[model samples]
Target chain A: MTPEELAEFRRRQKSRNWVLGGLLVFFAVLFYAITIVRMGD
Target chain B: MTTAAPITKQALPTDWRDFYALTKPRVMSLVIFTGLCGLLAAPGSINPVLGFTAILCIALGAGGAGALNQWLESDLDAGMKRTQKRPIPAGRMDPTNARDFGIALSVLSVCLMGIAIGWLAASILLVSILYYAIIYTMWLKPRTPQNIVIGGAAGAFPPMIGWVAVTGDITLMPVLLFAIIFMWTPPHFWALALFIKSDYAKVGIPMMPVVRGQASTRRQIMVYSVLLVPIAAAPWFIGGTGAIYGIISIALSLAFLALSVPVATRISEDGDAMKPEKRLFAFSILYLFALFAALVVDRVAAYQGFAL
Candidate 1:
């Protein structure tokens, strides 16, 4: 592949990784909240 | 000017935006809003964290259904002017990838809802995913003109599921909420179909306007609008909500019916802008959002002991 095409592919992959990472963190925090709330109930 | 060339999947790098586009975020917003109103309007209370989780699940499930729909109809989408720019048809993503992504979202949302909320709500969520993905997209849409009328039930479930998430069971109020959307869908969708009937006809999809003719679709829109007003007002009449919701419901519905008057009665000619049809289509969305927002406002008033 050309260098420019490879760079574009890397950029896309990096962005997807960021989104996936952010989602994972959000899910972890959400589960922590859910657990605490259910315990109090 | 850009060359008019064919797009192929291999030529494009899949981006997060394309993946996001597959979810039909605009429609998902409405589903999320209605689901939230149902949760807020239900008689009981839930933990704020749990409530957010329920809404998230509803939203994700909607996204999943939308992706699956696009996956299934990629070819049909390619044939139409409106849907040709979707991820699959635009060659930004593969159809199977969208399908797999849809299934993953669907399963994860249902499982999370069941674990965090309850199995009852989760069960309904599962049914909704199936209803939209299978029943509406695969079965009804290609086969019949009455597809959206029946398929509207799938969209109607979010509010019901939201209520059930809090109350853990179904009741008349939630059912009434369900009925309101169900009755509203025919006119809402048919108005859109009336204007875009050519796109549907090009793809051989049996939209009401294409299959039953524009005049028949117009009459049906009027008939459904008349039916919708009473249903929208039923919650107040049944004492499930206050006069605030009732007053707004009746007023908005009357306006909806008024707008439908022009759309239902008038026949369009070639090159007609279809302004009345477009107006009703736009107002129908606002009407639903306002209606549901009114329900939540009524609920809040009751909670504060200010019965209006």
Candidate 2:
């Protein structure tokens, strides 16, 4: 494979990782929010 | 190394992930969260184990409705970029399979809820699933612009169902919760429609913006936004919530109105200045979270004798 193809693949992989990371952060925050409300219950 | 030949297949592949996707987990999360708030707000106590089962059933019912919606709209979904990657449209699941799966879940969830919770909560869950899957998805969506307005009732039922789960009776507080969600839906959805207007138009879905135009939709959003303030504060006024919730409701309402007013006033010629619509859309999620969080906090604070 050409170096250009390798570079493009790496970039796509990085973008996917960022998307997954953002989703994880969102879920973590949501869980924390639920915990805070549940604290009193 | 030799390049492998592409495999040809007649039918789409399926997996657990695809089945999960059919349920629309993202939408169900919000439904479950709001229902939990309702359960927490009610006056009576429920068995913890039973309550958990009730919530799980509610989530499954919501998921069932969503799967049925996707199955019905699979064709239209393929035509729209936003929904083109959904399981059905992406060739990961067959429409008939999704239809059967949704119906099965719908029955299972309602039956389990009836046995574990009460018939009242279970019946409401059954109606909610039916309302969304059949009334909204099959009947209203393709036919009219007012679909979401009437269809919002399905989403509004969770709190009532939750309240019933705890108390086994309907009351003003749960109805107030229902009304809050009912009134909030249009503005919340219209804000999203503003950004995705073209998609609805392309599919002939007759969303408010597509039918009445962007300007009219913006006006309607502002109207609903203003209306939501009083409705949100009703619980506080009626003593279901306390002063802290009252203050939070007012503040959040103001923030929502502040965001929506600009969208209402912006001229279409000023292209994209209606970005406030999108801002309001994002804030709407936070607005709901804050209002419900305030309710839980006030209840806790009062229980602790921190208030008059």
Candidate 3:
């Protein structure tokens, strides 16, 4: 592949990683909130 | 303009979907369901968050074991038609990657379970993973015809683990739940084996029908099916469950036995149809789902102060 295609591939991969990382953080926060609510009851 | 060079195509990149498939999500669903039923049926209540954590640990542990199984059995899986397209066997993922992913998930789930719930549940989860990955996948599967008989215990542990997560103890009820699944596995697996005997033979996996003749395998399936009826009813007899579960268990077990009768009795020649075996295989899945659903329902009814 050309250098341009290689650069594009890396860009796309980084974006995918960011999305997945964000989703993980979202779930971690959600779970923590739920736990706090249950513990407070 | 300069002439463009011809571009070569490369293999598609492995995505999260391939990793998900390695976990055998379909199988994990049943494991989660049974584990949740065990949690729900236990005597006392747990915090919802902890309850969810126990079930999540069960799922992750089951997934880890599944990934490890696929990693170890990639060669045999490639040989079998049913499992040939799995991520490892299909060249979608590296075997080492699958193994590492499995181990990571297994360790993470156990640690989280210990921290969030109790160590007993985490320990049982750890054992279930090792039992499936090492004992069943590595040892019994290639060596013995009775692999499913003993290996079924790995699948049976989830509910007991869930119960322990709640009570932090093992009791007769959880053991009875474990026994029901343990007794049910042979008939369920053997029926599938009877129909797909060629796959096991091709892979050199010593499944019952491959190691023993079909006649013997069928007889054993019937024997287990017969035994499962009484074993399934034990929870009700012991006052762990109510009559609703008892009645459903009897009906389901009888249906399972009736389905097994033709498979056991009839002699199918080479090139003969395997309708009975196929039916039993299909019904066996339904039988377990229905039986466990009834258990949950019975518990819910009891919780609502209805005598059943």
Tens-place lDDT per residue, model 1, B177-231, is 9999999999999999988889999989999988888899999999999999899
For each candidate, how many residue pairs have backbone atoms clashing (under 3 Å)? 0, 0, 0
TM-score of candidate 1 to 2 decimals: 0.97
Tell me the DockQ of each model, to 2 decimals.
0.72, 0.04, 0.27
lDDT tens digits, residue span B1-308, model 2:
01111222112235456778889998888899888888877776776766777788889899889989998888888878899888777775667889998998899789878866779999999999999988998999888888898899899999889889999888899999999989988999989988888888887898998898888988988999899999999999998888888888889998999999988876465346556777889998888878877877877788888753
As for TM-score, the candidate ahead, 2 or 3, is 3
lDDT of model number 3? 0.87
Most accurate candidate by lDDT: 1
* Best-performing candidate as measured by TM-score: 1
CA lDDT of B112 in candidate 3?
Answer: 77
Which of the predicted structures, 1 or 2, would earn the higher DockQ when compared with the native? 1
- Mind giving the per-residue lDDT tens digits that candidate 2 earns over A1-41? 46775665566557656766985696466446545545655
Q: Where does model 2 exceed 4 Å of error? A: A1-41, B1-13, B269-274
Clashing pairs in 1: none
Best candidate (score: DockQ): 1
Interface RMSD of each: 1.6, 9.6, 4.2
Q: Can you tell me which runs of candidate 1 are displaced by over 4 Å? A: B1-13
Give the alpha carbon lDDT tens digit for every residue of B124-237 in model 3.
899999999999999998999999999999999988998898899888999999999999999999988887899889878999887889889989988999999999999999
